[model samples]
Target: MPVWQTIYSELSQYNFSVFSIMEDKNIEDARPWIEKSGAKFPCTIDTNHIISDLYNMFNVPTVVWIDENGKIVRPNDVVVMNEGGAKLVKVDPETYIEKIRRWVINNDPPMNSNDDFIKYKQQREHTDNEQVARAEFLIGQWLYNNGELELATQHFETATELSPADVMIQRGTMSMRGMDPMKDYGPIAGNIIKKGLRLYRPIRD
Candidate 1:
């Protein structure tokens, strides 16, 4: 987040700003990082993973580049924020930053052509099961919030089954199931990998 703050600070003069969302079950879990980052740009907590559902985002640090006119220049893609994060996610943070810099400074779209963008969006469009998973997740979240843990867990489990690759649905419900997400992420990630699925799929340049 500090890295994001730096990027925002450097690019704001060019009319580039960031609206970061942290996908945590509660604000208190996200508040420390938010306060520590001291980010001037808008930072909010997605306690119910609303942004994830809206953008078809499955992973953390997913970026959706939008222009001044609010058009999506780039859809949801993994953007590891820092060097340590790059190592964990196995992506070059510098490359992601360079893309952002080029886009912000030169007004370049990340894709080479509209055809490419359209094809990419079509390929990554939200599936019917994913839509249903979002609804299930919402019901689960409400149940969990209202002290119906067992019933909530059932819905969460159903949601994960519906969207097996959606980390926001899988890992996001860990705390409700009495698991530490950070500590238990390895098994979940391993499962995704064993199934020949990628957790981080970035837009090609």
Candidate 2:
């Protein structure tokens, strides 16, 4: 978050602004981190995971490049901006930042607008079950907001089962269900790995 603040400080001159979103059910869960970051950029909490649903994003730290015209030039790309984050995600942040710099300062596109990039974005489109899972997740959120905890939990679990790879639905709802995301995510992550599923798939240029 601090690194992103620095990036925004550097790139805002080029009319580049960072809009950070936390896909947490509770604002309190994301508040302390937001306060700690002291970020000058616009930061918002998405209790319903609306951004994820809109962009077909599955994980945290996803970066989407939007142009001045409000068009998404880059979609759902995993970008870690710090060394620790890079190591954890097994991605090189420097290269990604270089792309961002070129795009922002030089007005160069992030990657070659080729068949591969087109295919990558196409692959990111949500599957039918995943779309159903999103519906279920939203229903869960509605139920939760309406004070139907048990029904909400059931819907959340159903959503997770329908789209286990979607951390937005799985880990994002944990806190609302009285589960520790850090502690509970380990087992779910382990299962995902055992099944040869990737929690974070970095699409490189």
Candidate 3:
């Protein structure tokens, strides 16, 4: 999302922020990107997955639109800032800035027509079930790091049910695919952790 900021929020001159949702799960994995982006914007941690659960977040990159009344005037696919109140079009950076100024001066909401609203709504995917799966997956990651393979397997497998295509969840599921953990971890703990890691594919892999 940040990569497209030049043409999106930055060009349009709107404040942007990120919320990394987890169930009190640690996400040191994102440290490098956070530092490098030099975004300066505060990134929030949603330990309870409260916002994700309520907003039907299934994917990592999802957007939500909230109105001034704190109501979701437009729920999903809130990225269509090219829409000038009703009509959507490709605008130059100058045009985008002008529209933003008009909106601010007019005290008007970013507008979308009924048709545009329908299209946006159709794009919103996922629900609370998927959010729970995310939380469980994070818990499994914690367990795996702490040498609690058996407990981690339980949560990881459950996460696959909610989002079968999710790579991290799939890796955890395949990690124990053919191995007998009790035998492996008991006799060769070091080999088990390493060899078990080999079973689960990384995103980089």
CA lDDT of every candidate: 0.86, 0.85, 0.48
Residue pairs in collision within model 2: none
Tens digits of per-residue lDDT for model 3, 135-185: 887787677768888888788778866755443344323444444434533
For model 3 the TM-score comes to 0.48
What candidate 2 gets wrong by more than 4 Å, as runs, is none
Q: For residues 52-100, what per-residue lDDT tens digits would candidate 1 score against the true structure?
A: 8788898887888888899888888776766687786676878878878
Worst 10 contiguous positions by lDDT, candidate 3 = 196-205
lDDT of 2 by residue, 1-205 (tens): 9888888889899888999899887788789989999899988999888888788888898888888899877777786777787887887877777888899999997667767678987788778999899999999999998999999999999998898888878888887788898888898888878878888877766
Give the TM-score ranking, best first.
1, 2, 3
Ranking by lDDT: 1, 2, 3
For lDDT, candidate 2 versus 3, the one ahead is 2
Candidate 1 segments exceeding 4 Å error: none
* Colliding pairs, model 1: none
